[model samples]
Target chain A: MRKWSWMTILVAVMLLVSACGSNSSGSQHNKQQSNGGNSGSEAEKQDVTLSFIHWRGEDVEVLDGIIAKFEQEYPYIHVETQVFPSDQYQSTAQAKIADGSVGDVFTVFPGAQFQAIARAGLFTDLTGESFVEHFEPNLIAAGQQDGKQFALPYQLVYNIPIYNVALFEQHQVEVPLDWDSFLAALEVFKQAGLTPIAFPGADIGPGQLMNSMVMNNAPDEDIFVKLEAGEAKLTDEWWVKTLAQFKELNDKGYLQKDAVGAKQDSSIALFVQEQAAILGTGSFHLASNKASNPNLKQGLLAPITVSADEAVYEGIHTTTFMLAVNSKSKHTEEAKLFIEFLSRSDIAAEYANGTGQNVTVKDVEYTSEELQIVSEWTTKHTRFQPRFTISNGEVQKAVTNSIQAVLSGVSAEQAAAEAQAIVEQQIGQ
Target chain B: MKKHLRLLPFILPGLVLYAVLFMYPTISALYYSFTNWDGLSPSYQYVGLQNYVKVSEDIIFRKSLGNNVKFMLTVVLIQTVVSLLLALQIYKKSKLNVFLRALYFLPTILSSVSVGFIWTFIYDSNLGALNKLLQIIGLESLAQNWLGNPGIAIFSIAAVQAWAHIGQMAVLFVAGLQSIPAEIKEAAILDGASQTGLFFRITWPLLAPAAAIVVSYTTIQSFKAFDLVFTMTGGGPNYATEILSTYIYSSAFLNYAFGKAATASVYFLLLIAVITFLQFKLLRTDRVSY
Candidate 1:
């Protein structure tokens, strides 16, 4: 009984010590702030730190600059940025948000993920915010749930096929304007012992490729919207044909035969090294490629169409990353201030220049040549292109898997049927 | 009442932490499993058994369940047998044996994500060490896409899981072997027992407790497989390597079906519980009072 009493006393003392330790540290922080307050004029108040979480490790330096500028402008508000690896970010962010420990502002995708969180009122609805007025209407709609805007886009990503200019010139391969011409050019590249396109079969590469193909060939704009609404099915002829086209490239050996095992970075490396003629990637990669190999010339072609009959749908233009203020955050006002500061055209231009991407602000100019080309492509082919919306993620996964299945000796019909079943099951649930 | 009060103070912090961190979540998961909660929604309908029914008919979930069972069985058998064999070989305290033991255990200390990346590079068709080694040995035809083939991807991943963990099991077995009284082995040897006979009759029986630990630990770890599968294939090459954890993750985070994910977790918990219980029963050994 004496030993038990001593143990209980020790535990209580340890707990008290820890509690005191925390209290002192917190008071120390307060003391430093108060000292600053004492030194500064009456106008300067205590510091308010807002936590901003995002997944872009590459953009850390750029974000730091932006944060520094924002801090200078709003002296009392400081933004502490937290970043996670892209692959783990979604799950980590979701877990944090679910646990009610999300940062003041965090990056969110525009589709199902954004919608799921937005619908649950996790994000403070920015529907009436003045900063929301600066973004494109289509982009605002992309991040909308019902009638309320919950996300604010900062950058635009254009998903055109970036190509090696030297390789295409070396092979005398003309840029293919239609599906048959694309195949012909690919066959030419294959004959020259070059990989036509370095497709990463192991990741979202297949899905992106299929989306580009389907969008290029799509007869109407509402395919994805219909699928999301359950008014359509994955077994639709267009989707099957899209997978078949992807498989046809695999069959023809234009896609690296071993691509099914190769990752996105590895496949992109092939293109960057000029081992492949074309790379189906976004315009965002141009600056990085130039930095890595300055001598290697790169260019973009309009996304391929299905023969001469269908109009080319250019490429999927969507928000690169969007910011959403956590509804549960204690510092919502500061978060809003930071978001609005980012929406300024000068800051948007600086970000675009730093990141080598296009911004969503109305007056922000395309800072890079790559952005200009993307702008040209989208401008020329606006009529046929679908408005930027998040595709049904389940359907997208099904199509990607179907492409892999076709390459793995499953018949196109069988693969399509299996994918259809999976999508239908997803819809049914 | 005083006796209970004294004990309660000693355990209070741990009990509070456990209740807050573990018990609360587990109980909440149980409650959420019966609802139509999307993990984010403030409002959810009570849809009892619907998520489970959906899971029962979900082909991908069924496939994932089968794959997980295969993963668990393969990992348990391969890890246990391989570890036992290696432990026997290196149980002695020679410098070489200690070095080999440490060398084998090196992988166990590496994060699963790092191991997955290392193995992924090793299995790469064009640049991988495995394929290059085959090329060097004039067995070029034998070099196949180890991770790309749907038929073998899961097994390949399982093999990696075993490789990464078998070392820890071997170390555990070694500890078990060392704990066995030296006199027992000497007595068997003095009786003119064959080495194999002594091992089977004496050494093996004594190693049961350790074997039970290894088998049980590996079994649970295998069922909870996530990082390796997530990094290696993301349960890809056409859902060939989909396991319950990855499926549940996709359902919850990717597909936004949190109710289904919660139900899957409950099922997973029950499965692991039953399997571990069965393993404990089957591997139960008489206490050696040496």
Candidate 2:
């Protein structure tokens, strides 16, 4: 009985100590925030910790080098970087923001995902920031919502699919400059018994493909925005044509048999193995592909879906990796400083060369011939990826599903009608 | 009261953990199911069954439910039978039997995501080993796009789920098999009972508890087979492999409709409960006595 009583007493004592420890720890935390190391010794002075979160696991090495440079320049601030896989980043970021533990600086996807975070009132407006002037206006406009620069675009990517220039040269096939020429090029590849385009029909592949497919097909860039507001419908000829483009690819044996099951990795492998002539992805994959197969010469193919005269946009481009300071951040000025440092011409050039990406910051030169080839689009008539303009994921899924449905043997008309019905339901909601 | 008080200190941590982690989320999910929360934002309106009404009308939800039922039935039937048969074949204590059982159980120790990736390579339409092997054997007609075909995608995953868990269920059956009274089996054999007759009359009857356990566990396992489906196919080739858990996740994460996801979760909870209850009743048997 005495032992039991003592054990109970010990348990009570533990609970009391735990409660008291928690209270004092919380108070000490508040005190630390209030002082911010001002009253402490020189070693403790202005030692601010800034959390920077991004989803590019592949860019971690390059980003780490950049962050190290940033820290050396700004010794008073310690930046913690959190990198998540791109697959789960959107949901994870949203959850972090909701739980009030979001990064001091975080990345936002252009258009829909940006609109979502901006709508949540989490973005610290960057319109007045001096770094905002570093980016080209047309490309950086993607990060703006309702005329406010909520985020600043960094990575300037051409959404046009990357094709094998070596394959084209070997087969005496020219780079297709128009719809008719594109069909002729496909015929050349098919006749040679190679897949004209390696199509990854699953996951984000179909959606990414839509950007290039619909570039010249849509009458205007506001078509997706209009669909959201009920001013336009997905059943419109432009949208149907986009779905039909994929159907035509399938029907013509340009893609592999049962291409509907293929994934991005598999298709990329096929391209690297020379089983396919064109990889149906973007410039974002250039660095990885070069690393995978050095002999593989790459070129961009935007697939002009209309006559040269009717084409308004020559290709698709997106300014993504939109960096924004969180509205709830404690070290907003410090976070902004990091973003500003990245905007410096020399630093931006380094990032561009390191990542093999086209940074939106002006005067950043590309050393990679592949990137140099794609960099010409920075001066061309490039349309922003239209699919990103749809702020609703379900609506975006519906539009992308239309293409998938057509690939799976559904008629373009029926797929368009089904997609339009979903649009109507969404607009009604 | 004194006895209970003495136990309080030991139970308190576990009790608090259960309440905080499980009970709190469950209750909160129930509350959110009644609202129009977008998952991330704190602000939301009380919609009062609007989400339920919408999910009922949702075609994808119906399709996913149908897929889940098919997945569950296939996994439960296949896993239960295969594991039980393996248990019967190697239930006796021997060095060879022990090695075989360990080999069978090895896959269970692997993480589902790792297993999903390995199996994904095996199931790939063009580059997969399964198709390659089939073609090499001159059985080209038997080659399939395992994870791609809408008709067989769910079943392909179901087969994986069974294969991944069959060892654990077999181990459980081994214990049950060992527990059967030796005298009863001896008597059945001495009475001129054939091998088949002896198994039906004695061994199977004694294995009721294990079968009940295996069936119940398998039924529940099929419903929560998320990572395998997610990493393998992501419920695609146009939702051919979409099940309840994936559907709910898509509603919350993909669509950002937390209210709809919560409602679906409630439906899923009720579904598992009803199925598990029916399973128990159908497999009910009296506790054996000597």
Candidate 3:
């Protein structure tokens, strides 16, 4: 009987330990909360591990350089980093957040993804930090909620098409500043046996193209954002016109044949091989395109949908790749320190030059030829890429799908009606 | 009793792992299905069948479900016929057959992601080998955007899905073909049964177990394949390729509606279950013996 009782006791003890082990994250969260009270040299004496997670595998090399510098400066704090593929990162990061195993710092997209995570109280408040003020105020708006800065937008991009200047010059075609010339240029390129604008109707290309498509058509800037607020409808003239442009482009055979099936990489390849006159992806892809074809000459182009005189905006520009510290992170202080370190003008310049991305850090030198080419457009009147304004991914998907349907031979009005139906459903919900 | 007690430690580890790893999460997912959980937050509003009702009414869900059925039918019908044909040609033992078997089975060994990328390049309208081959043969008029066209995109991917696993299914059929005793085949030949008659009466009926396995497996794999669709198209050209698995992923991760995703998942599981069960019943799981 005693032997049996001893065995039962051992089993019970093991079960309890396993159960307790499962609750380690909860205890860790408590420890993080407790650690918030300590500061200065006392905190520095103990080594703290800060996990930084992001979805940009392309920028890993540049990020590693930044991380290495930060570690060198702040030896007491060791930063661990992980980069998830863009497609799978969101769900995986959400799972990590739920389990309290997410990084102390993480990168989030500007609008819908950030809003979703922020609503769940995932981001540490950065409003009090002085570094928040150093970033251009407008660029940082994506990360602010309820008058508080929840994150900092890092990447400044032209979210429009990047044209091959050499192709245009070789064809004796000047840059088209308005709708008529844009179409004319496309015809010229078509006659020259080149794909006019390499439109990726599939994947994220359609959504990103929305910024430039509606840039000059809208009554004001941030029209897509206003559409989400019920101030505008998808059936409105501007949106219908946007859809028509896609249709007209497709009908004229300016966008590559079977553009609807083309993904981002294929479209970029078309542009790189000089078979396509323009790549619809802009500054985000400049470095990669330059790498793929070193001799390739690229220039930014966002067509004024209206006549040049009527156009209010030169192009679309937006800050993306918002960085935030986890609210529940055990190493929040150290994570914030790393973020602050990255925000320094010199550090941001190093990042921008190395990655061929323009950061929101105040007044950084542009040494990369691609950056120098796009530098002037940064000073021009450009609207924030309006696609990021819709905080609902489904509604956003519908909006892009409408454009794709038009590209695939649907009438603009019909596409708008279908999209409007979805927008109405979203509003009702 | 002492011996059984000694074995408890080994069993306990596996039992605990199964409970914690599999059972706990599955049960938690079920719980989340009934509530409006966004997957990020711990607390959620329990809305009973509200998530279910919403999913049924969603246009995207209906479209995706329709796509899923079309994809499943394509994959199953094509994969079944091709694999069985391959198995019949090579079921007999030979050195050449051994080499041919591996050649046929080559695709199944590669990861779906790699296969998807390879196929994507092959299907490219301009630079892709498929289109170039068509043009080379002066069949340029027949060349189409394999993935870009909304109408045929799903089928294009389904063909690849079938291609990926046709070898695997062929191997299953090969095993089933090899299992039948040679004496039975010899007896049938002596009975003056026509080749066609022998196939329908003996070979096919005897091959039921393997056909059942192939059909059921193909159906399941077709319905659940995510990486292939994601890598090739990411359910695009305007949701034309959006099947249930991709739809569920978009719902949870893209839409940030985990409750709706979970609700969709329940229906998705039921759909695959009902399909496979119907297949099993049609094939009659009771083996036809020699």
Candidate 4:
């Protein structure tokens, strides 16, 4: 009797262990099946939550309005938005990507950065989609890599020379159209006891502005393209001339004395306060100026007086902010739908008018005067200069540093040569 | 054997975490440094010392290393002196001492990002308080672009970093000072030793362990300095403030050169290891008995 009872207990213990194992395995398998089933069903379902990440603090109100409209129309599919501080965006986004916690949709800039992310397969490809056709051809080109589209350019930016119209009119300084005329205007402004131009050499974006101004008049885009391709050296005559011009401006005391140290906001403040006569920036600055100082009368000039007689207003369409879908997102379709909706001309128009974004949608009507100026510039200038898009980040740093060097009394020729060397070293050319 | 078996559970969790988090990545990083991996792509081709060779040839990397050394020296020497002085002053029991200690340590408690932003405004050429104060005090000529000039930019950034951490160091020093027996100080006073002589002979000698700890912490912190330089100048004004960590970050994320970044990390780790080893060896003095 005792042996039979002990045998029964042993069997019971074995059965319990086996039951637990099978139960856990069964649940895991069930989970996999349900996940697959849900993904399949998600395609047909309209109700979903899509998260979007951006770093545009200044345009938060306009973005919120756009989100509200989106939510209103697609009630079942709610859109959640998160904005990161601009300075920490890259690091934060990189960390999120590493941890597999990035939002369903995120913003990506064009150039080598976009290429790097795309190469990593972090973003979903949206090529050959009807939504891509709606973007401007130049913007489409900016977002493409090896025949695949990884990002959609939301805005077409034109690096135009913006001047204080009231300051110019008050000082009786005619708007310059070419390099010589621009230099002549600088002298006149300097002689009149006014700072001629304010450039933020301390920040990289402003430094690139100086380079873009010279590149606008290059005999051919080949100079820059060759440099990018490692075929051209920085010691080229065109680069030398470009650097020399930068030095001349600095040597003549035309630029702000503390230009090298000036922050972008500080530089903008000077231009808005009419402390400086000219500032080189995108047409988007028009709206920014109005927002910051409603009283300041600002005028836009196309690519600061380039030497090109035929393409006098040659400008580069920098890859402005763009929205990309995370490849690893469970709700990729929903995210893609959100991107498509955001890219539509009508929706873009609402955002542009509401937020003063210089969006690139061709069919969008301009409601704001600032946007109208950008539209006018785009229509007039068909030929566009390609901004520093495909260069390595080190190359960008080198170029920015070279510009800083020029502002600090280093000869432009020397700075350009050093920049060329740095680029070559970075690309292993 | 039973005792060893019982001890296993206590150390297992820490061992597992360290192996997974630190050891695995470290070993992988060392292995990846030999390849041409960009942190993506399924396969990587072995480059075999190319990254190391490139590090030697890269001028920017060399400049970054030099800058890091300079930052460490400045932060350690200046911060140590300032902190020691402040700690000495705040070692007393008066209410004023507590108030002053709290005030000094306030900056350290704030995030480096906030401190950087505040300092940026304070150093702004046109709108900054520093220039305004200079103008008000008739020292306008001395006020130049504090963070804009390459010659003074790195040191200016270092000053901010030092100011931010001085309080923490001072507090640590104060604790060390207080830990010293009061009877010893009284005995020195009774022996007719001057305050300065007593400080040099008794207090400073006994405080060697604290000083060593402070130096090691400051050195490590200075070596990895990123946020302030990133926020303030972004290693700008002709790479004046570029440090090793920022350079490695730009190489890895910005340039997508993961192999080079890993190599940089390896170098940095080796450097820190050597410094730490030497510090302990040199600073491990005879312990003071109460």
Best candidate per lDDT, number?
Answer: 3
Give all TM-scores, in the order shown: 0.88, 0.92, 0.92, 0.88
lDDT of each: 0.78, 0.83, 0.84, 0.76
* Per-residue lDDT over B22-89 for candidate 3, one digit per residue giving the tens place of the 0 to 100 score: 65555556667888877666456889998888889888889999999899999999999999999999
Q: What is the TM-score of chain B alone in each candidate?
A: 0.95, 0.96, 0.94, 0.94
lDDT of 1 by residue, A1-429 (tens): 687688657655555455335434644553443334322233345687778988888888988999999999999987888899876776658667543345778888766667677766667778898888777676555667778888887777666678888888888888887888888988888999988888778885776666577785565677767766678766778877877787788888988867788787778788888888887666677788777777878877644658666755656666747788877665677788889988888888788777777777877777676667655654545421132343445556776788889878787788988987877787773
With a 3 Å backbone cut-off (N, CA, C), the pairs that clash in candidate 4 are: none
**Tens-place lDDT digits, model 2, residues A213-235:** 88888858898998899988878
The per-prediction CA RMSD against the true structure, in angstroms, equals 6.4, 5.1, 4.2, 7.5
Off by over 4 Å in 3: A1-42, A97-102, B1-22
lDDT of 3 by residue, A1-429 (tens): 688778757755555565434435554654566355234234764798887888988789988998899989988888888989886786677667544355778888887888888877788789989888679987888899999899899989888799998998999999888899999999999998889989877776788788888877884766766777778888999999989988898899998888887878889888999999988877888888999999999889887788989988888888888899887776667778889999999999999998898888887888999888767786788888888888888889889999888888889999998888887766553
Segments of candidate 4 deviating more than 4 angstroms: A1-42, A67-76, A91-104, A204-208, A217-219, A302-313, A326-333, A382-386, B1-25, B186-192, B286-290
The better-scoring model by lDDT among 3 and 4 is 3
**DockQ leaderboard ranking:** 3, 2, 4, 1
Model 4 interface CAPRI class: acceptable
**2 or 4, greater by DockQ:** 2
